[model samples]
Target chain A: MSYHLNHLKELESESIFIMREVAAQFERPVLMFSGGKDSILMVHLARKAFYPANIPFPLLHVDTGHNFPETIEYRDKLVEETGARLIVGSVQEAIDSGAIVEEKGYNASRNYLQTHVLLEELEKGKFDAALGGARRDEEKARAKERFFSHRDEFGQWDPKNQRPELWNLFNGKKNYGEHFRIFPISNWTELDVWMYLAMEGVELPSLYFAHERPVFAREGTLLADCEYIHKRPEEEAAVETRMVRCRTIGDMTCTGVWESEAKTIEDIIKEVSIARKTERGGRTDDKRSETAMEDRKKQGYF
Target chain B: MDNYDNMELLRFTTAGSVDDGKSTLIGRLLYDSKSIFEDQYDAVRESSERRGEEGVNLALLTDGLKAEREQGITIDVAYRYFSTPKRKFIIADTPGHIQYTRNMVTGASTANVALILIDARRGVLEQTRRHAFIASLLQIPHLVVCINKMDLVDYSEETYEKIKQDFEEFSYKLNVNDVHFIPISALKGDNVVTKSENTPWYDGSTLLYYLENVHIGSDHNFIDCRFPVQYVVRPNSDDYHDYRGYAGRIAGGIFKKGDDVMLLPSGFTSKIKKIDTFDGEVDEAYPPMSVTLLLEDDLDLSRGDMIVRENNQPEVEQDLEIMVCWFADRPLQPRGKYAVLHTTKEVRCIVKEIRYKLDINTLHRNEEDKTIGMNDIARVVIRTTKPLYYDAYRKNRITGSVIFVDEGTNETVGAGMII
Candidate 1:
């Protein structure tokens, strides 16, 4: 019967609906694009939400300066293809202006500092709502996040005092200066995202598939040999060739790759289907503490 | 290979006492369906070992928040996603404690099915009736009373039938249209994903089986057309100019390409020229499908304006009678003004009167006490500054439900089902 929708189609409809709501409700809204799979999927859904007509909002990229060069290239290409405006809020700018302090040591990352740049961008753009691809299944703290997550004037998320989002009726009412971090795909798990991408034939960065990349092992996780990471003198991390791929894309200093031979989307789906570890298991940023994500989210990190 | 990508989506909410194995039931569902990853299972296993629990605690899987884990209680509603080969499920795992009863209302608001867990040993407690009442009040289409911990009750048919009879007696008072009873042991893995041989006398589909096969297609009202325009798309480009389309998710009924529609408040009439999606134009669009409608005539319409079939129109009124479940810490004061959010529309409203407060446990109406505190359900009469196009809760759920946001704090203070 035509009554039931396929899982992927259903999720697409849901995401499109949320994107439309954000466009309709907020005075000025922007989609947070990281050139990652989830963000790419969100941008793709936004296109579907308002076809023929351009996406009402621009894509805001909170650049960590530690992102892969390929990611930047990919981001520019997508924006060019869609004819959507791109606004870059650089962490380097924040660091240069002494607005945010840079972390030290080998494990130090620009992940946390990106929040400051993001907040600055929101203020600069006067955007009332920021659409993010943060999924509930990504982390424990994210599990409690609402589709329309209300942020205070300081852009801090109060997990304790979240507005009850029931049904498709999202309460977008907010005071001036206070904004919302709306997650259109909050209900989607990592697997659902991968499957949707595969079904929709949406392209992602080359880093997602397996390829020969020079990487080093640190804290029992594979870190890409990039200029962003600072290795201590005592710790020996030699560049070695390995078939690796990123489960979750982020700043090179914080994100880690996993050993995989999955080169195609179908292969990646199969690998993910039987994958034991959580997608963030390879993330060095989340390993900082028990509630690292929650702490950062409270400080306005998406 | 199973085509899970084509499975239909089902959103369900679970309600029960703190120790009634609500989390355990969800864990069982996720674990059995292979939704739980190996790392997640190991993490939970390690946590259980650290806590010195006897076995790998399934309940540990659902206790997602750090505060919940520290306190050993679910403090709020946590949305959990899992999928079977047949269907996809979104479980709104709400806390069962009395203080967090509003969480149950929040969770049940969008659910197609309300899953109420009953401890077999305890039979039907007041808590069970309370949850059932909330589910009925929320107008959740289906009710599945899962009699959990059957192993503790010796898996006896007599016990199952007794509990079923007691449940039926109480359910008679509920307005739930579809109700099913499944004797399950979330801990023992019986009558959950597979049919349990323990209850040979009670031949019924397993919980997962029933969830997959439940008749939810007809759950939505396909009779009355309701399309609350969320946004208007006008691309000022070289390729195509002078094009205006209304973008929104169809709240109810089927909208065809050549349908005559009327816009609210503006009293403008237009005929649908095309129902478009990103992929292409479609023959018809139904409830929950996000599509763009290009009307034959360009009417002055924006967000908050609704388009409906001229013949079947919803009640457009300013005075609303609603059964509100208060969510804020501050009690709702009579004549106090708050922001009322319905669909995509937001309007300022004042509490005109309090019809009565509903005691969830006893289902008693206390008209004497007028103060609507946190987790209290009361029939509130609200007078909005602007008219809200709506329908009765029984007729159309999407348009019927509304949430009140405090003007000062901006917190969603109350959830209401229009009576």
Candidate 2:
């Protein structure tokens, strides 16, 4: 009777409208899944968008071959439950095929190599549009992104030369070889995502909840003590069990955990409401430089 | 958490150059409202120190692109979000330059309010007129004129009055409906988040308070029922074999169950059987809510079709008079063929005639000059391949606007408002 939608419902409707637009506009579209909360939210919205019909497209996961065991398990279960087709783009295959070289150092990460594999897989699948869950509030560079972002044949983003998007009309037209990176949740913030997840009573990975894990202190951050991460002698000696949870999910070598006791969704919501740091503050991939995300985005890194 | 279900979303656009302290005002809003995280503040502080700035430069918080940071100017529209207990705000921060009119138009398309910043000492520059003119042309419901830099003018009542008078005199020719004025200093944080005592003569609320408490419930058109079908949902499974629903976001008016509706392009009349959403069925659906409508009788309907009230129907016309803002480098060729995207329909249109171009600064119509180039506003006539159901822009924004995409290049070239 109010005739007015709240902030969360408004955001949800906007995102659903965008996803339906993509389905109607593009010929061969795919959703990019990373087993993160944002991507999980995207899958849920997509399911609600076409209600009785199966999701009109498959989900593309660019696996870095170094992920938390729980993430892979969650991804498989979600795919099966949603009845969605899954397509994996493997970074390990690209590294073995000599398409990309893995970094060699104490802080080696396959995060940068995933872009190559993703582009190659897109080319293989002949997908014209790939939907992503990247939000504008995540990084400074992403703040300037449009809902329908165009990419050249080389899979590069030209930040300066973007189409002018007006109102709800989105122009998804492109050339033969070119494609677009569509973001349905470009307007939602980190806290909005958490609140929506909690409101819907959605299931998330156990990594998001606090649990005892072996972590080591590196650069004032608690990195999970795993074989994927190459640590120094002192770091190895400093490994200890701590109660921590992941604010975000990404490559195991790059994502850091926050020490916390918040276990339930309500506890996480309360924590996020009073948290003083941005969600990406714990992401090691973004700390390299001020324009690190911009540089990576230009090279077609989602 | 209790207020989460009742909070509203307000989107507004701000237009100003770097000197008007636009970035500083935004930073102050986020900081004072406890929206800016500590890490973001620390990053801005470090960047300021690296640039050898005297103090923490608030402008560094915005200007996201690498080139923008290096050149100290915003090239494109950047969106920023913040929320209070009562409302969540989205700021479409745009640059106020003569060449960036396209960017400003893009940002102003969806904004409920347009914030125009004017330097108190400068007193209504050309940029201010251009911004106000665009906001009015875009038909933004409300306008907030903030006379910035009150501290530089010593917070004098005379200065504020003079500037307010000047803006009012110029705004008389504009079509803006609701206008509010406030005096603030973005640098010293006076009358921005909290009211300032320096301006004891001023009786208006602060900028944040005005934004939070603005009346926007009546902004939507709720009298005419209009639903542009975007997609057709058909779940052909064993659980539900004979289900057909028209999915779309309501463009105008209110639609209730068992109401008589007519579909466009195929004039089939039917009664609404039910209104369905992901959560459950609703008794009625309103504007901006995406839902599926099930009719009592099965009718031939697809995308680009519209469901409207039987008594109130939009004008079906093949020829349209539109006021267009060109956004591409290539000049709009007379008698050119382009792709036109209306509510949920795509059709081909040819440029029939170029009536006249408007000078935004002087508010004069140039009938002699007919060349419409990038960042130019002109009146045009176009004929579509198929008739479109539309209303005047002033009547309903959602059902009356369109975009022209170049057929060859596939780029969005111009934005048009039905006249």
Candidate 3:
């Protein structure tokens, strides 16, 4: 048991080291908080990185507007508790500002629109480093992402061209306009996230566990109740109270939920343990053939 | 009773040249281990159909780049994760192309194991040995020489034995301690996930089994405590204002709360008052744990400084002997100096000497030749502007490893393992 705890401790240390490198190497580094489990774990890890000191960097959220209310509430509360600054880059603002055109007709999620706002915010804030909680195992394109990903002034990521990160020493020098995207928790999988949560006793939003909610089925997945999202003509759902929880949350227009009775953290661990599907499987946006995440990532999507 | 259930995380990297079936081996491991999902399999099948391949091209699962998909080779490090109900593994899938050698160095830096895939038809080729040499220079604890495509070689134990012997004879000069060879056909699923009937003479466990069983808990250095302060934690709060914790991940050994430790670069002594995590507090800390250590005495310490146990201290020096894996496209400058990074410390260092270059194909050391080109593995000496606290790479991979950066270009040119 001691050794087991030691191994977990090792993982935490490596992550913390990366977090510190971000702080030391970059200027105005900010953490991308999605209110998802991965991002939540990242926030938790960032706390350990600079304990006794408030997370030196602020937490940034590229709001898609279409979000589970629980995610927004959790984000505010976590930031408040940690005493870290919170910066919001709203996709709806981008749409309203006419910087990005909202999707038309059915399946019009602001997931893609978040890129414009996020890129603009980074430019305006002069953030030299942005920490994200993206895991490589989540998608094929993400699998090839660098831990300290370099982005051009235009906020474009060239998978072909990246600086090699050798050892614990990270190279963070860049042009005035260029910035780095750091993924301190890049090696973790969904299961590892759950286990760490259990071990750390980290808090989470209620949306993470099973609960009754209004929903509709689309693209072979359940969609949570939201105003902006238009209901498909053929879909029908009863207002039944069923145990359910979200594995991932993005645009209220596209994120889905799975039926489960995993109310407690222990129950959720067991449920996720036997769960065969990946967390991304709950997202309808990624299900759009292959390379959706890749295309968006290239364009600087959070 | 089950050791596998114990927590042990292994970070290994896999690098391969064109047509090395690196993706196949990865897919094979995931598929046979039941890590593959039904939807993922379906997507791969559909993509295979879209690509007009006769069967599922498991490589499609990882070569996510359009250029790589078109060229049928990996161009970047694709990190893959899996667990065998024993040790969880994080694999840095690096490309073996000459231009991608930098990626390989990045991948191998954090790895405890290096799984080198060798085409059975081509025994001990240039790329194969180059990978092995890099693994050795990086001081990877275990090397799994997976002689893949055994089906191409008729599953003959004689062929397996010959390749194994040739590899062993070549690796003798290298510093790799644990070397293993497993003949497996990643395509046919032979000895990758389950025991293979093709080679009954080979009674070894499956490749996955071997990876699962390899002793990696001891790979880390528990002999010396080295904590490189990454940041100074000063939470401006009434409950924790006096709590100026030296925050860093433990690079090696263990540090107890009451342990007397010396702060490096400043040579100040302090006692660890607490090791705090979000889960409240811990009694002690070890290598890789990112716990915040609070000291009873707030001595002069900052980022890039090291914390070590008083009785068990690492050697402090400016000049160090290192075995380096050259990753720059431009050949290493003979007299040029660059910035060297070890742990969180950065110092200026020059290539003091190039002893010899290893012939990757034959695994022979060519003392007469000295070319630190891309993917070149060589022994060299470096003189640093500042003294770094370090242990031998063989002794402590975390503290002994360093990376050189081209100050002008800001590109990481090489990775060195202290000898």
Best candidate, lDDT = 2
* Interface quality of candidate 1 as DockQ: 0.70
Runs in model 3 lying further than 4 Å from the true structure: A1-7, A236-243, B1-5, B310-312, B352-355, B362-371
Candidate 1 ranges beyond 4 A from true positions: A1-3, A231-238, B197-201
TM-score of chain A of 1: 0.98
Q: Each predicted model: what fraction of the native A–B Cα contacts (within 8 Å) does it retain? A: 0.76, 0.78, 0.70
**Residue pairs with clashing backbones, model 2:** none
lDDT, candidate 2, A161-266, per-residue tens: 8999898899998999999999999999988999999999899999999999999988877899999999999999999999999999999999999999999988
Quote the lDDT for A151 in model 1: 91
Residue B191 in model 3: lDDT? 92
- Per-residue error at B3 for model 1, in Å? 1.8
On TM-score, the candidate that comes out on top is 2
Residue B57 of model 1, lDDT score:
90
- Model 3 lDDT tens row, B1-419: 13423557888888666687998889878877777777788888898898899899888877888788888889988888887777788888888787777777788878888999888888777677778877877777788998889999899888888889988887887778898888999889999988889989998888888887887767667768899888777878898867787777778887888988898988888888888876679888776677788889868888889989778888999989888888777888877799998888889998888888877666677899897898787888889999999998878877888888899877777888898
TM-score of each: 0.95, 0.99, 0.94
Instruction: Score candidate 3 by TM-score against the native.
Output: 0.94
Between the candidate structures 1 and 3, which one is better when assessed by TM-score?
Answer: 1
Question: In DockQ, how does model 2 score against the reference complex?
Answer: 0.84
Calculate model 2's interface RMSD in Å: 0.8
In model 3, residue pairs whose N, Cα or C atoms come closer than 3 Å (at least 3 residues apart or on different chains), thus clashing, are A10-B288, A13-B289, A13-B290, A52-B235, A53-B235, A66-A252
